[model samples]
Target chain A: MSGLEGLYQQIILDHSKARHGDGPLEHAAAEHHEYNPTCGDELTMRIRLDDAGERIEELAWQGDGCSISMASASALVDLMAGRTLEEAGERIDAFRAMLRSQGAGEPDEELLEDAIAFHGVSKYVMRVKCAMLSWVALEACLTEARATRG
Target chain B: MEGMSSDTLGARRVADLRLDFPVFRDAGEHAPAYLDSAATSQRPARVLDAEREYLEHHLAPVHRGASAAVGRSTTLFEDARATVARFVGAGERELVWAENATDALNIVALGMADASAGLGGAEASRFALHPGDELVVVEAEHHANLIPWQRLAARTGAVLRPVRVDARGLWGPAELAAVLSPRTRVVAFAEVSNVTGFLAPVAELVALVRERSPEALVVLDACQSVPHRPSDLAASGVDFAAFSGHKMLGPNGIGGLYGRAELLDALPPARTGGSTITRVTLEHAEFLPAPHRFEAGTQPVSQVVALAEAARYLDELGMAEVARHESALAARMAEAVAELPGVRLIGPPPGEERAGLVSVVVDDVHAHDVGQYLDEAGVVVRVGHHCAQPLHRALGVTATTRASAHVYTTEDEVDRFIDALGGVRRFFGVAGAGEQTGVVA
Candidate 1:
């Protein structure tokens, strides 16, 4: 497949259009906003933790950006919902490592789920930031959630 | 090449003009249609050769030491200053070397801030601002022009009065006149807006400032204008103007700041150190006049030489013809892009005059997507708020995709940009027949 085609895979396009969990959360333990100044892409993420604060009850986001960012946010919402905070952190790390690898790192499909689609995004240095925007926000939200738990 | 007459260079076709730039030759068939000259222009062989020739043969510290090498270097540097000054319609003493246009503006602003704090003695007192004194800036100004005034206002206890732009991100002389008052100390604006390609009426605005705020000093952000159009800073009657070399087919790391000779002599140097001083003691130091007073550290000598060559290259081609060519390209891009179904053109409408650039926002698609799509088709363009976030906010779009032209840009390149842009919404599954078919389940 061509690079542009690979970067804009079918799954990524669908997720971007579907935009699951794309509104503000009414009750949330933590929220973080990430802005990509180079392109003016902005994403605001809100997370609601379970009463015990060990699991993510919901992950929601509101943003205006390109397909890569919107799709990444949508995939994050689907992949991290009901997962433990520790597991979410692990996924964030894996996603970040894979994107930073410039298409070198082997992504575990079992672990990454639909986010493996972003493996093609690693090849583009400029677009990598777009794909990683929501993941960065998730990491920040996780940090805020952990602090709130303590 | 310097011996070539203006008629020959001016009459050269766009294809012939493209040959002068080695970048196109090196890239061969793979060279993207370079439409982003508004950001930084590609240098021609003449400019590159000039810089290399200087470094290979005549490398020495300028304006320092009584050595023969120093004298030669100083002579070359001063001669470059004269060439560039004449290009911009300024006397040799009126121009100061700066890191880039941004630094050029900061020198003026910071110097004024110093003046406000009782520096540069009685002469600089003219620039000093009192409490309630106003600094007028336009909303559409690039951050480089706007932020310095913001800091200066904060430092000098001055009020920053912004002349607001319309929804198209354009402000006119009338809007400028509304903001002018006797209390206005400085008026800062761009000659051509980097984002919207709006060509400001400089002389009219300067006249308005004179009528309303006689004491106000007009500062022109000429980063966009000095490159693509005929410029006469002295005739425009502005007190100060700033522009970058890289934007004008010259080497990077060098720019020019044009100030009225008397004003530059009186304004305190923002940075103080070697080369700028005439004599120094533990008590106080005396500085040289005008250009020397502002050039504190070791200079970018080679870049200055190459910049002069770039000026000569443009002069050989004749700026009037250059402007005429680029303006036609801008109109072509604007008129075609305006016809694209789901695209909105920024700045002046199709028939009106603007600079040699066109900025557009695609409906249901971000500028990043549009830029990427254009890139895939080998069409290079600038995409973002373009360092004018406030202007973007005022225009109700986060970013825009801009296609700018220079002397070498051809009709084919503009068509490629427009053709690629037309496919953006469809490819992204936002609109058109392709929206339903291009996507996979």
Candidate 2:
């Protein structure tokens, strides 16, 4: 497949059309907003921390963006929804490293799941931010949730 | 037959002129169709040669010392200024060198900021803003023109009042007149919009502003107009105007600001340093006249030489002919866009007068996807909000796909763009039978 086709697999197209966790969290611990100024894509991501303040109880978000950004956000919900905050942080770092690897890093497919569809996106330097936008929001929301965990 | 004959002549001229640009020569067999000239134009061989010649042989500090080399360099530099001033129909002393159009705009805003902070004394009071004074700008302004005015409003406590754009992302003299009052002190707008390619009636608007708000100063963002059309700044009667070199087939990092002599001399220099002052003491210094007062440090000398060559090249070709060539291209693109199944034209209608650009929002497909599909098919276009977020918001779209033409653009390139744009919805699996999918609709 061409790189553009690979970047827009059937799985990505499906997730983008019917994204998971595409709404606001009523009982949220923190909400973070991120914007991609290059194309005007924006998202407001919300997270609910567990009572122990070490785990994410739920995660939800609402925003408008392109297919790649929307699909990546849907895949992030599957990869990071119920994990501990520390675990989510590690995965976010690994995803960022893979994106920066210039298509050289061999990510663990079992761990990333549908997020692996973004492998073709790493080759194009401009679209790397589209895949990373959701993860960056997750990190910021988690940090804010942890800080204000009263 | 008369129309056909002139069309043939214009097409032949474009074909003959293509040889002057080196990029076309280097890409002989498989040249990508370039349609993003509104963002920047390709430099001709003459412009490139002039810069290289200056740097390789005749390089020295300008307006600095008494050395023979300095004198020669200064003469070349000042002669370049004279050439550029004549091209834009401005006095030589009224033109100031800037880093780019963005810097040229910032020079005005920053100078006003200093004036508002009580820096330029009684002479600079012309630029100082009172708390309730209003600054008028259009919603379709590029960020380069918009953000500086926003900041100026913030610093001076003046209210920023934007003349609203229509559904087509356009505002006419009527809309601007509606916003003017006795409290309006400044009016800033672009001569042609970067996104929608909407050409403003500059002389008409200036005349209206003078009649209504006599105290207001008109600042023009001429980045789009200077590169594509015949422009005489003094004849237009704008108080100040800014344009860049890179957008007009010249070297980057060099642009010019044209101001009336009175304003340039009265406005304090925002950036203070060596080469700007006439005399300096341990605690005080006095600045030189208009252009010298604005040019604060070591200048882009080679770039100035190349930019002058670019201006001369355009002058030799004749601005009226250049305008005719690009306007025809624009009309062709607009007609093609109108005929497409799902593409929506953003500027004035198909045959209406516009600068040399066409922007559109494709139905059921994001502009990024459209851009990618066009790139795959060897067509280049600008895809984004194009740094006009408020305009996009007003148009009810996040971004748009823009195809802009310059002197080097050919008919075949415009055809490629239209063909590739027609395929965007189908390629993205969004083509439906006569269904409107744009959010605004």
> How closely does chain A match the true chain A in each prediction, as TM-score?
0.97, 0.93
Looking at candidate 1, what is the lDDT of residue B145?
96
Across A1-150, the per-residue lDDT of candidate 2 in tens digits comes to: 276687678788788877788997988888889999999888888888787888888898898888888888998998887899888888888888878878887876766767887887788788899888888999998888767764
Candidate 2's error at B70, in angstroms?
0.9
Runs in model 2 with CA error above 4 Å? A49-57, A145-150, B1-12, B434-441
Candidate 1 clash pair list: none
Q: Pick the candidate with the highest lDDT.
A: 1
TM-score of each: 0.96, 0.94
**Clash count of each predicted structure:** 0, 0
Q: Which candidate gets the maximum DockQ versus the true structure?
A: 1
lDDT of 2 by residue, B75-114 (tens): 9999999999999889999899999889999999999989
Q: Rate the local accuracy (lDDT) of all candidates.
A: 0.90, 0.87
